[model samples]
Target: MGSIDKYIFKTTLASFALVLVSLTGVIWITQALRGIDLMTSQGQTILTFLGITGLVIPALVLIIAPIALMIAISHTLNKLATDSEIIVMNAAGFSPIRLFRPFFLATCVVAALVAFIGAYLAPDGMRRIKQWDAEITADVLTNILQPGRFAQLDQNLTIRIRERLPGGVLGGVFVDDRRDPQERVTIIADHGTVQKTDRGSYLVLYDGNLQRFEVGKRDPALVAFARYAFDMSKFSQGRDVTLGIRERYLWELMWPDEEDKTYQQLSGQFFAELHDRFMAPIYPFAFAALTFAFLGAPRTTRQSRNFSIGGSVFAVFGLRMVGFACSVMAVKTPLAALVQYLMLFGGIGVGVWMIVGGVVVEPPPRLMEAINRNNERIARLFRRPATA
Candidate 1:
């Protein structure tokens, strides 16, 4: 690569890295705040939280990579124009296509990185996050109860304990269980402890009072008991992970079931997601080109800098939103998919047109005359004194 190309490449890459990190940090912070309470309630260790956070990196990359690339290219080119480097290059007989090569190369490298993360790393990370979340939920469900507190296990079960014993035992226990809709039962025990048997896990009570109230009957029956047991195993089932098109791999989406109607719908969604993942990386380059086509100009005047940079950034954002809307609509209308592809091709066409269309305008005659006059005055000011 020539000196100018190398210079532009380095500048663009530096900008891209800065933007990518800033954007990813913002996203990570948001996710961390939202999940911190759930993690603490589940008694998850720091390492577990970090691991899950790490697993989210690819997902963040999927959103950050394209925007970073677009911003980087726009900023770098704008800087070059503002500094008159582009003017010098043009003066040296370089065309817009020649100047664009470095930026395009950088875009290609970023696109490759995005593709790798989207196609492989993202799916694997999502799976790990799901698995860890499920394990944490199970732990919380089984171990959240504490002594001397009113613990509500679910909608139908509540238990209060006065104290915890050495083992998994409780003293002065009160239990209200309403699993049966026809009858409601309340039990009070002077002492109780959890027990695991061949049948299931249960809480065995001693010296307790039992009250049974039938739903329809007005009469409530009370019975005093020396021993009583209530089953606790029924509440131990872990939470199920939600599997969506984003969570499944390509093959799972394609062949969810041979004979299920839901599978066919899922298969369609998966196909759309797969195509989107593959297409996401290219968006960076396409957006970069589109921005450049609209913004690349020789900054011969102050107005040119403001016009090109502001207009380019606004146009880039607008195009991105349009593309996202089209992708969403594509889920229901196949024609929207064509629109997405057209956006990409349209970006390329714009770039090619910019390269082939020649510079937007010749340097203003008045500005050129003023610049020449300034040079002449400077030369005269620096001249040797006339010979004596």
Candidate 2:
């Protein structure tokens, strides 16, 4: 790279990093707040809360990187224009395509990062999140009951205690379980403690009475025991590590197991996700090219670039929305995925043509005149006479 190219590359990359981190951090905090219950109610530490919540960062970056790249390219181009550097370069025989080299390299870097996150990092993060969430739920069920409150451990199970005693003993324990439609079991114990063995978790109740009620009969079977072990492992088991379409790895999406139940039921989703992953890396390049084509020209101070900038942003947004629509429709019709590819490549082609042909993107003179007239009328309405 030349010295000029290196300067533009460094500036654009620095801007990209700053924008990416700022935007990702803001969004991550909003998402992480949703998991605050882990620390507030589940007896988990702050570090655990952040760790589980932070796993979502890879997924967020998969969406934010392309937008950040576009913003960085726009900023670099605007700065060059503001400093009249673009004009100087143009006078020195530099073409728009020549000036676009640094931005292209930066966009490529961001695109690769997005591709990596989408293919591997995002799926792995989602898998870890599911595993850790299941484990934490188990721990919460076993150890984190609040005193003097009724806790619904599951849809059909409710547990309550009068007070929590030291040494992990629970006082005034009551458990109502209706998981089996054919029967209901209620246990009232004076005191109990949770125990975990190699097999599973159990609630060891002392001085408790168990009442079993069958659905057909009104009368209940009651038994009093000095010590009883109630199995608590059923609630915590079988909830770990299930992969959805979004959680599947790249190769898994490409060559999914034909016999897998999820693949059978959600085959359409698999098709959509596979195409989305393949197409995600193409967006950054399209965005960079469009931005340069719209705002890369040398202009005098009197010429406003606002319309061009707005046009570029609108085009980028429209293209992305089309891609999203195509991805959605691709779930049912596999051919819909081809639309996004066509749009992206077409955008690149148009941008390149405009850049190479030195076409200046501007609003029509009539439209600008109408806008100026409307602005003047609004300004006149807001203006007041000054005191003499």
Candidate 3:
């Protein structure tokens, strides 16, 4: 609320925004590339590919928001230290806790955004991605409509055509089915066409010979037919959206459909997901506080705190990894979820205490300082001329 708070708040927020957009954009492009085959190989347009890929941004943002907050807070503090602004503030009788106000506020803001994304935006985006993928998969014929090439429709079906004739006529058609364990089927037809109805789609072959061969006995039995209908249902079966945990909304994770046996079996995953979503928002504040406690406090000397910064990063990263492990462990034991809270809030409390307490939270631990000094000495020794 004060001038100092507002200044730090603006700087932190700006840094976070820049980092968020830049990181999200870089990562999103890599992920979106995975879907490029939809446009290149499949019949999808550029807009369709972009639309489906763009839906992924919300999920990426949820992952990046906390990290951006950490970087932003650290950057602003380091910049202020470099400019001697932090020293001026300390000279002006401002405490570390007072200086932490704006950074804390900024962290809280990012945390809330993460919570919202996890609850609604991320889940909704995931659902959209699923639906889009399913739609693309179900339309198998449309996706694999290339003429004069063999197209593998499913695990055991392959079809090739000499050409696609006008008026939906397929010329020089060859279809093979090997899905059955006991027998293999091959159908050769001079002409064929696909029929899609409300009930299901069918591939009708005219003037074709159907060959069936037993797996153990290879002598084939052949039957000639004027007309035969092959079901396409297997290629385009509808997927049950409820089966996917990421597709389910937050409420569904908390209170799932009771009658579903799969949900009962996967109860641990559901609880884990619920706890993770709720806990993601809390990380920003904890990480921000801890980082500031390590790197934000003022010192009379203008010496670099690179070691302190590295230690802070590793410490925070280790904590984040621990939280990740806790989420996995919580799936098996519900009590593990409590460990996340203890670690997060405990780190927060310690960080704040370091800031407000009169005694110094050393810029770098003595061990870390000693390691750096030793490393520098080794590097200088290695660089010196060996035999002058």
Candidate 4:
């Protein structure tokens, strides 16, 4: 790599990093907000909330990196053109291929990053999310300890508290249990506390009475007691965690087990996810090439690069949208997945042709020019100062 390659590569990488971070931060904020109740309503700490929600980031970056790379390329190329750096490079006899090399190397880096995220980080993050959810569900103290609301431990058992005071005291306790076929049990107490141990969690009722009713008779039996303990072990039952196609590793996705409960009855999604992981990493390279095709050629005019930028964006978006559609169809037909490969190659082949042929694909300038003239006219009318 020459000094120019290092410079362009460094500049593009810095811009790419900035764009990726900004876009990912905006998206992560939106997604994190949806899970804010994990702290507000679930008695969870802020760290817990952030950590749980942060697990989705790798998957999100997998989707955002390609778009960011494309934008960074357009930005860098446009800046170079506007400053006449591209013209100087062209006059100095720098071929398009040489100028394109640094960006292509950057594209390779982004592609590798995408592949790692899609194959490993994303799946590992998903697994963490699944594990976190499972842990939270089994945590009675954190998940079901909300004050002044009825939380059902099971279909037959529910517990409520009027107030969860400071120092771990519970006031106005109510318990309803109907697991027994022969009777229903209702317990109310003035004060109670929820305690956990190795054995299990238990609701200790003080100065309370249990009212048990016979299933078929109206008469009920009241048993007065100084203290009673209701076993709440059932609430913390550990459920078996099942890994889905999204959580599976790359090799697992390639050779999924039909008998695996996680993938059972999800054949369409299985194949689709496998192909998507493979296809996702290719988009970064294709998008970068497409940008080079649009803006790599030298231009003498200082025209706005908006048209070129928009055209590149549209092209990339169209290709990706088609790839996604094919992925969906591939679920059922399997053969439709080949369209993704075609889309990848077609983008690169067309981009190479345009770059070699000195083609600059830009949006229609006439439409934008007309809109700009109308805006100028409106501004002039508003600034006439006749009213003064």
Ranking by TM-score: 2, 4, 3, 1
Highest TM-score among the candidates is held by which one? 2
Model 2, span 238-257: residue lDDT tens: 45467788889999999999
Candidate 2: give the clashing pairs.
none
Which 10 residues in a row give candidate 4 its minimum summed lDDT? 162-171
Write one digit per residue (lDDT tens) for candidate 1, span 1-388: 9887889999999999999999998988888777664444443456666788878878888878988888888788778877888888888888887788898889888988988777777887998888877765554233665556778887888888776554345768888888789999999999886666777667889998999999889988999999988787776555767665676665555456666454565655665676677678878878778767765655564554554566667667777788778777777776777888888778778766876685463346797789889999999988958877
User: lDDT tens digits, residues 272-384, model 3?
Assistant: 98998888898898889888988987865656587668867987898899998999999999998999989999989988888888434455468768888999999999999
lDDT of 4 at 163: 67
Predicted structure 3: clash tally: 0
Estimate every model's Cα lDDT from 0 to 1: 0.75, 0.88, 0.84, 0.85
- Candidate 2 local accuracy as lDDT? 0.88
- Per-residue lDDT of 1-388 in model 4, one digit per residue for the tens? 9998998999899999999999999999999999887766664567888998999999999999999999899889987888888889989989887789999999999999999999999999999999988877776755676778898877888888886544355778888999898899999998876677889888788988999998788888999888898887776667678887789889899888778866778878888899899988889988998989887888766566667777888899999888888988998988888878888989999998887777867656798789889999999999988764
- Mark the regions of model 3 whose C-alpha exceeds 4 Å error after superposition: 143-147, 150-239, 358-388
Query: What TM value does model 4 have?
Result: 0.79
Please give me the total number of clashing residue pairs in predicted model 1: 0
In terms of lDDT, which candidate is strongest?
2
Q: Could you tell me every candidate's TM-score relative to the true structure?
A: 0.69, 0.80, 0.75, 0.79
Q: How close is candidate 1 to the true structure, as a TM-score?
A: 0.69
What are the C-alpha RMSDs, in order, of all predicted structures?
10.7, 6.7, 7.9, 5.7
